[model samples]
Every structure is written in C-alpha cells, then in structure tokens.
Target: MPELLDPRNDFLFKRIFGSEENRDVLLTFLNRTFMEANKPLLSEIILLNPYTDKDSPTDKQSIMDVRARTTEGELINVEMQLFNRYDMEKRTLFYWSKLYTSQLVEAQSYSTLQRCVTINIVNFKLLKNEQYHNVFHLREDRTGIELTDDIEIHFLELPKLDAGSISLQQGGLANWLLFLQGATPDQWEVLTMNEPKLKKAMTTLEFLSQDREARMRYEARQKFLHDQASLMEAAKNAEIYGFKSGVEEGVKQGIEQGIEQGIEQGIQQGREEEKKQTALRLLRLGLAVSAIAEATGLSEEDVHSLSQSLE
Candidate 1:
C-alpha cells in the first residue's frame, strides 16, 4: 500500500464507498449514521451513480456525489466536501430542494415524490456545536410536529470528530469517519478489527492508492480542491482587509474634520465673547448703545441685552 488514499477527497471517497463493489461499505456507513441520528436504518442501498473510469474531472456534473436509493425508495445523496465555501447552510438547502424536486416529472402526481435525504461530509467545522453530526427536517416552530418525512438533511463536520474519545463499542460511525479522514495503517488495523465492514473500505483505498492512472486523476482533483480553497481564502482575507482599511480611513477623516470644526467654532465664539466684553466696558463708560453696538459689531438686540445685564 503506497500511502493509502484519503477517502475524504471526494474522488477516493467514491472509490471506497460509492463503487458498486463497495455497496456494502456504503450501506454500513449509512446504517451507522442513521443509528447515531436515532433514525430508521436501511437494509440495502442501490447505487445509481457509481464510480467509473469515464468519470473525468471535466465531466463532473454526474459524478459529484454518491447517489443512491434505499429499498424503501427514499433517494439519498452523499457528498464529501474538502473545503468550506462559507455557504453550506443555503447551499445544502438548495441541493436538497433540487434533489427533492427532481423526483417529479411532467404529469406526475405529487404523490409520486419520494423522501429525499442529503448527507454532507464537510472537512471544516460547519455547526457551532462540538458534536460532529446533526440532522434537520421541516417541522412546526412551537410544536414539534413534523410537516412531512419527504425531506431530510445531515451534516457531518469531520474536523469536529473526536478521534480520542471515539469508542467502537459506542458505534461504528466514529470509526467510519476516522477511516475517511485517512487513518494510518496502524490505526486502520485496530479500527477495522472493531468494525468489520470498514475492511472493504480500507482495502478499496489501498488498491486505488497504488494505481498510477488513479493517482494521476486523484492528484488532479486534489490540486483543483486546494487551488479553490486557496482562492476562496484569499478572497475572504482581502475582503476583511478592505473593510478594516475603509473603516480606519473613515474614522481618521471624521476625527480630522471634527477637530477642524471644533477649532473654527472656538475661534468664532472667542471673537464674539471679546466683542460682548468690549460693548459692556464702553456702555459702562457712558457711551450710547447705538455707538457701542456699531463699535463692537454687535446687533442692537445683543447690545440691549448687555445693557439690561448692566442695570
């Protein structure tokens, strides 16, 4: 095994858990996931879009996720996201709606629509909680009554998975997530021993890791993911810097303008106060109010008020 491929890298994830030969692998993972969520488990999952050599990086529309249907006819889409686009909430809703609505066709009754579930395995932290997995559905706000069972969404933020705290006795989901996170050979040996189904997933990864062509495609996909992450990160950093610079510049200009206005008002007020004092002195010396008003540049009303203050 030449450095086992990371299953979180969507392409390798398809090879490990989305291939027809690895159907059991996907089934086990799904069961574990549902068990953790306290939802009903599936007996079998039919893979509609399995991995193929023709799944090129250029033709990605169909090969983007592991599309499956359960024996109960519920549609399920599982995707591995290597980077956070910062729109996971709305993006997940958009994709879920697409999947839910895609089930209907022209002249088809709304009754024909099956329950659709979307599982997003994101590499970055998505939820504020420390828990690694969460599920959502349409429900009444005050009452806990569910509108329907036709829509379901799950988010498994891999970065929040606590490897040390995971106990195989508790569940197999933790083990499966760790395997996807690219567990070391030694770690897999222990994890696989506890979860028998993970053996196939590990074996698939090992077989695919050494294939020269697969490695080439994997590297291409890896490069694209990394480049996309870098580009998004650069854009986010630039936006923050731009906002900070704009705020600082605005504050600096506002402070300077405020100081200038304050100084101008102070000078005007001081000149007016001097005029009032001169008018008072001249008035007390028996000069007429009109002459004092003219000499001091004070309005007649102002001079009158000063004279009243004197009296």
Candidate 2:
C-alpha cells in the first residue's frame, strides 16, 4: 500500500472536496454534516472558488478555501485548518462578516443579502467543552430567540473526535470526519465498503497520494503551512513579551519621575535620604540592583549598599 497523504493538509483537502470533478463528494460531505447536526440539508451547490492545479511556482501558494453557493443562494465557506493560532473564534466571525456583507452591492437592500455559513475543520481542539463538533448562530441570550438566520459557523475539531465510537455501518458525518482524520488503509477499505461517497473520495486520495507530481505539491504545501505556523507562534510570543516589558518599564519610569520631582523640591541631604528610601522600597519590591540604580539616580554600588542595609 502506498503511503497516504494527510487529508487535513489544506492543499489536499481543497483538491478532495473543492474540485469540480468530485462535486458529488463535496455535496455528500456537506449533506452529512448538516443532517448530523439536525440542520437543513443542501440539495445543490455551485462551487465559487473551484480548485485548479497549481502549475507555476507563483500559483502554488493559492488560497485553499472552498467557497460555494447553495441552491437557496446561501453561501458556504469550507476550509481545513491544521494548526491553531488561538484566534479562530475572531477570525471565523471576521470572515463570516465579510462574506455576508460582500453579498450586497451598492444601493442593494439588506433583503438582498443571503445567509452565509462557515465550516471550519480544525485538527486541534478549540472549544472548552468535550464535544468535538460545535455550531454557533446569532441568538438572544435570555430567551433563546434567534435574531436572524443570516449567519452560522461550524467547528469540527478532529482531535476531539472519537473514531472508535463511530460506526462505519451508519455512514454519517462521523465516518466522513474519520476519513479526513487519516484513517488507515484497512479502515478506509471498511469505510468505503459501506459508504459509496467515501469510496469515491478514497479513490481520489489514493490517486493523489501516489502521483509523484501531486505528492511534491503536497509536500511543498505542508512545508509552507509549518513555516507559517512557526512564524505566527513567534510573533504571538513577541507580542506578549513586548506588552509585559512595556508595562514594567512604564511603572518603573513613573516611580522614578515622581521621586525625581520630590528630590528637586528638597535640600541635598533630604534628596539623598529620599534616594536611599526609594532604593530600599524598590529592593523590597524585588527589583534588580541595576533597575533600582537607574530608577533612583544612584550608582549600582550605592543601590547594592542600600539593599544590604535593608537586609
């Protein structure tokens, strides 16, 4: 058996579900997801951003989201996210808002806008609850009254899914989620035996996994995703560190400025006494000797002497 590529990879995911050739596969997956959630099923869909082969180097970095419109004119955005940057909640809302607002043209009435749904298949757990699948909508908090049916968001956390509990014989959303979570060949064979849509998807995955050119593209896409995740993590850490450092520095400067003002108002002996007291207080606050020196206008040696005298 050829090594199978991870369907969670955005590149392979778009090719599997967003391709025009496998429209039925996309339809089946969407219907299963909706039906499992007790929501209205999509009968027909028109792919908006259909998958196209990336032939050139520039084309290899194309956006890998699948945008479609249902027969009811409802827009659906499906995308697989392999890593959690801790901003999915806000990002989902931002994208959903854009999609909803973009539907209306200049001077077009609000009634012209259609319902927009975003389906996010995430590899990592997002919500605090144990449930793997979560759906959200605009609803009143006190009375459970739905404000509008215009917006919807679904998060399918693959890491939280229990494949062992899912029965392939039922052939519902669980089976599809399992398939995307990289089930083994034997498991795929069993799943495909029961689910025809899954069988078709498995065939496509196999073909793509085996093709040398497709594998190369998949590897390149995987590397790009890894590099992007690393960069995002680094950026987030830097932001947090910068915020904390700025706050500490601001507080220290504020204390130093107030002490300097007092020193300017008093005699030289009083100023030296104030400096010693300030240094002692900073030392008690666990500030470093160098920081106390900088804040108190005293040399490091004087700060050290003050610290010893306090001890």
What's each prediction's TM-score?
A: 0.86, 0.79
Q: Tens digits of per-residue lDDT for model 2 on 1-311?
A: 57999999988998899999998999999998898789988889999988887532124343788899999899999989998878999988888888899998899899999999899999998999988888999999999999998888999999998877877787888888898988987887777766788988888999999999889988888887888889899999999999999999999999999899878767788889999998898899999999889998999999988778876
Clashing pairs in 1: none
Model 1 residue 83 lDDT score: 93
Local distance difference test, candidate 1: 0.87
Give me the displacement of residue 248 in model 2, in angstroms.
4.4
lDDT, candidate 2, equals 0.88
Compared with the true structure, model 1 gives a TM-score of 0.86
Query: How displaced is residue 179 in candidate 2, in Å?
Result: 1.3
What ranges in model 2 sit over 4 Å off?
Answer: 54-62, 247-311
State the lDDT at 216 in candidate 1.
89
